[model samples]
Target: MQKLIRRREANPGVDWAEGGLHPLLARVYTGRGVAAPDELELGLGHLVLPDKLLHADRAAILLADALAADKHILIVGDYDADGATSTALAVSVLRDFGCRHVSYLVPNRFEYGYGLTPEIVELAITNGSPDIIVTVDNGISSIEGVAAARDAGIRTLITDHHLAGTTLPDAEVIVNPNQPGCEFPSKNLAGVGVIFYIMLALRAELRRRDWFAGRKEPNLSQYADLVALGTVADVVPLDRNNRILVAAGLQRIRKSQARPGIMALLEVASRSPHNVVASDLGFAVGPRINAAGRLDDISVGIECLLQHDHAAARALAAELHQKNQDRRLIEADMQQQALQLLDQITVETESAPVAMTLYQPDWHQGVIGILASRIKDRLHRPTIAFADGDAGEIKGSARSIPGIHIRDILDAVATRHPGMILKFGGHAMAAGLSIPRDAYAAFHDAFVAEVELHAEEVMLQAVIESDGELAPDDFNLELASALRFAGPWGQHFPEPVFDGVFDIINQRLVGEKHLKLVLSHPDSAQLLDVIAFNIDPQEWPNQTLSRVHLAYRLDVNEFRGRRSVQLVAEHLSAAE
Candidate 1:
């Protein structure tokens, strides 16, 4: 492992001390390019209102007319955590806004694959016979499917957050931050965030037209909890706009007024809503929703989010909790098998570049993407995994290192072998594709060739940024809580990681592979509990008195009836 310390510096356009932030916060904000005190304030007033978002008013108008006519409206959602949450948010808010005939359909990873495929569009037509279709977290890449919807006399409204293609989809109202002509400042809004903005605009339009004169206009802000859950879960950059959404949602969650489903999920995960943080969403709630998509039908997740009844939501949350457990077991088995396959491929003598492509006749298709991620992390190389699909076809998911773009690599393969890949689309880091089983070798070779052109790029050392060293005084509960509330942190705006040198006073193995260590810093003579999850026991140092460097994030761990600060160790090494 390589460690490079990069100092945080103020952006050229930003003022640090004059930004009216706490000293530490000012440093972090300026490092992230915040120029004014207004950028640091997370008040809802700072949020980009619906009208400020381009094409949002037009989308609201289109939706209002559809609702007035009582036309059937179908929501097409992606099969991931963000997609599920976006689907539920749109369906619930639309119904709350007086849309009489609103329903949702999520594509099965096994059958319909991903995104707004022509097959999925046809499925929606057959099942719901909708007059209009709204896509969430998907459809930006569904050029053919949008055309098909038009041909079927269905108006398409796409609300997605994915990177747009060269040719935009022919939707009646396209609400995407990544669209070429769109000038939305925050390009990191999750799919759920985009849908939430549309709801805000729709509500505004209803009020302007006196559509809800007699009835109460639903407080659309109530759904920010869902937005926060989806945005953090989707791993989008926590830009200024996204931070406002998450901060507002976290306030609702802490007040215990979050959606019943989110509350029930909190119960199942043993996390208190009153103390919910971004980590809770990423670890506890996000995985449960993602488990439904990875192992079973994602509708289970959507139901958990949409079911307003407490009893029903609890039961569904429990079911999803169990599904997540089962998913862990399945993923463990697949990962082991993948490792074994890697061991069998002997390429030591060959100068062929290292790129991973694995296909299994029995592997579950839904979990291939996750398995690809696991393999990529382990080997530090671009990885793709495929599983047998219907009628001798194979479905594959690919994940890439920081430098290589997975979708571009797949596109190059497509160009090399015309008509070989059935369908493929995604962003730079992750992608999905399908091909006949017989063409797997050709596709794999083409991908390897493309990756070889960027070998130096892929082999670059990893850069790990730290928030500098922390004294034992900084480990207090007050400082930890302040760090937690410093604003939403994910992807780009990273959660603060601290590094320090310590002596291991005590050590033990706990819960199979976890290492529990008592580390003491000499500066203040303070001892801290450090837990390294899934660490290899053989790698533990033999000398207890030896100095060691540790990289970790401070977390408040609650056990039994007590709460205390602990170090969640990410990496560690013996001090030179």
Candidate 2:
């Protein structure tokens, strides 16, 4: 493990004391271009009203027309946490807005594949005969599918947060903040956030038209919990706009007034919504939602979110809980298999490049991305994992390291060997693709060549960023709460990492492979339990009283009736 501490300089334009922010926080905010106290405002008043978002009014008009005409409306959602939440939000909001003939469909990873494909559109037609289709979390990449929907005389509204392709789809309304030429400041809004914004706009439009004269004007903010869950799960950068969304959702969650499904899911996870934090959403709630998509159809997750009856919601939540556990088991097995294959290949001796491509006929297509991520973390290389699918096609997922763009590599491969790849799209760090099984070898060669051209730019070392050292006094519960409530933390705005040198006072294995340690500084000792998951004890330092440096995040762990702040170590190494 490599320790890299980058000291951030403060900006003179901001007053840290007035904002009630720590010095380190001020430095990080300044580095992230946050200038003044006003920039940190997180009140609902600061959120971008739905009317301000692009195409929101148009989407509302389209939905209103569909509702008046009693035309069937089908929602097409992606198969992920964000997509599941977006689908639920859309269904819940649309039903509240008097849309009666509405249903949702999520593409299966093993069957119809990802996004709004032609097959999915055909399935929607067969299932609902939808006169209009609304796509959540996906559709910006579905040029052909959009055309197909148009051919079927179905109006389409795309609500997505993914980067747009070169050619925009021919949808009636495109509400993506990341779309080209959109001046939305918070381009990092999740797909669910985008849909929620659309709902806000729709409600406003209804109010303007006096459409709420007899019925109640739905408070769209009530769905903020769903927005927060999706935004955190999607791993988008939590910008100012997203922070407000998550903060609002956290407020609702803390009140325990969230939807029955959300409440039930929290209960199933043994987490109290009244005390829910961002970490709970990311690790606990998000994974359960994503499990439905990864291991089975995501409709189960959407149902869990949209079901109104408490008993039904509880049952669904329990089902999703079991699915998430099954997903973990599958992921662990696949990761081990991938590692075994990687061990056979001498990455250092390979002259072509350090890029990795693995294929297993028995691998589950839904979990390939997780397996790819695991391999990439261990090897520190751009990795792609493929599984055989129906009709001789191979579905693959790619994960990239810091300096390598997996999507760009895929694009290069497609450009060099046109028609070799069936389809592919994603951001810099992650991507998905499908190819004919016979073309895998050629695609693999081209991908490796592309990665080799950029290999020097990719740093394979695990560099840990930290805020130096601090005393045990700084580990108060109040400080932990302050860190938790400071602002939304995610991909770009990372949670604070801390580092310190300590003596290993005690060590033992807990829960099979996890190592628990009691560490001590020069002045004080703390009972720190470190869980190096799946790590062998023999690989750790053997000296009984060795000095070691640790990079970790501070977390408040609650067990039984006790609450204590603990350091969750990311990396540990013997001191030089």
Candidate 3:
């Protein structure tokens, strides 16, 4: 799968430099659609007011009432990083507000599956006969689960960020920006972000009721660390609102004011809290937390976040780190098997299917999502990886290329084929579903047809967007450091990448799969240090190549207390 590089179109009309942005950073931000200076402001005051989120006030009132009446409040959470953070955030904040009998239950992915299912509801009842059930990061589609709780004489408040279905859950109050007719400006809130907003509203409600006269008011901004981790971990778009949350969170972590769990996770990942960034959270800490949910129960992660003792948090972090290591081994094996399966199918560019679906009966259910994502990126097509489920069922995790709404495609398949898919729900780029084990072939064909019906030719082609090229002057440490921190970038707001032709002064292999190189521009004699990670072992360190075109990021590499500019190559190819 060869890729095409396309530079983003810059907005020339916006005077980014006039807004006090560095020339290089100004150009990068302009390419990402930053039209005004205020958009760059990431202070807590710039966050969208909680009043705009539909039913946030009502939900706050509900939770406040529960607290006022000393009712048992139980949080139903999903089994992912966002869910863990949301559950922890809700529990910590409510308890900080002096609410007694606050507990939570996260459904294990293996036994109870996702969301608040009826089985999970029964489990929750047996676990902690609660008076009010607060669902964080889930329950938007748990129609049956909410009904069960309602029939059990329990009140339910649903706070989720996933796309709502045709019929909303019958919970007592729902707080989601994507819900019908919601006026909240940003709809890209992760599950954790939704719960964060609800907590803020709850604080306000409590404040208005004079409930904080004798109690210390929890500064919700302090919890931004959790919000930041969840927002980046869930891979939500970094819209201005989300950027504010992430920026605030990064500020706290950088000052070492983050919670014990975050600090402990960072320590395990070898990231310094004094200079932590959004990517550090997304790549290093987030994965360790998510590994708990993937390989075991998510309670390990939630407990780590809620723990006030540093030693206990570190112990949980170590466990999560081990789980992550195990997940990597399992994922590597599954990916190899998937690659072997792909080799058996069409290999030609033109003849290959627009969508790919692979299944192995022995594949670990916890890792199918990652396998699907890897295949989707490798082949630049919508991909789904399936693993054996209960008795006669097979569970699939789907990852889609751009321009294809995977969840909608699943919906179409379910709408047309009726019983082929048992249940499905997700956002545009990813989804999950289940079907009879015997119906694998039929479901695969139906899925391919639906994808082909919706996919465009260009959509199937892998393309990398670049921020154009950098000049010799731009290859300095100041600009690199500025660009690095200029963004809490993720998803929609991408980090800056540039492409240019460079002379390969020297090349060598480092750390087995990475390539280290010294390169210089044709016009400039100054050589630049470059490194590309996870390169193809069979094709790298080509001694015959004199010049190459490289897509890379200007990064500052620090070694032995020394920092210098280094280009991190994302893609490289021979140049004419």
- Which candidate achieves the best lDDT against the true structure? 3
Local accuracy of candidate 1 as per-residue lDDT tens digits, 1-576 = 334445566555655556455556565666776777767788888897777677989999999999889989999998899999999999999898888899999998877777887898889888968999999999888888999989989899999987776788888989988888788888888999999998888888888889998887898779989999999998887888898999888999999989899999999999889888887898899999999998879999999999889999999999999999998888899998987887788523133245889998989887888899987776667889999987978989998877788888878778778988987887778888889999999888888888888768425444566766776677887777777777677777887787878888888788878988898987867789999887767776445546778888887778998889999987787776
lDDT of 2 by residue, 1-576 (tens): 233544344466777776677775676577666878787888788997676678888998888778778888899998999999999999988888888888999888877887888888898888867998999999999899999999988889998887787899999999888888777777788899898888887777777778788988788888898999999988887888888888889899888778888898889899878778777889899889889988888999999899889999999999999999999999889888876776677545223256889999899888998899887776677889999986888989999988888888888888888899988988888899999999888888888888888878327554565655667677667777667667677777677777788788777777777767778776675556554555556765356557777777777778898988777777787766
Q: Report clash pairs, candidate 1.
A: none
Of 1 and 3, the candidate ranking higher by lDDT? 3
Task: Let me know the TM-score candidate 2 reaches against the reference structure.
Answer: 0.94
* Weakest ten-residue segment in model 1 by summed lDDT: 346-355
Clashing pairs in 2: none
> Each candidate's lDDT (Cα)?
0.84, 0.82, 0.92
lDDT, candidate 1, at 221: 78
Over all chains combined, what TM-score does candidate 3 have?
0.99
Residue-pair clash count for candidate 1: 0
Q: By TM-score, highest first, what's the ranking?
A: 3, 2, 1
Candidate 1: C-alpha lDDT: 0.84
Instruction: Using TM-score, give the best candidate's number.
Output: 3
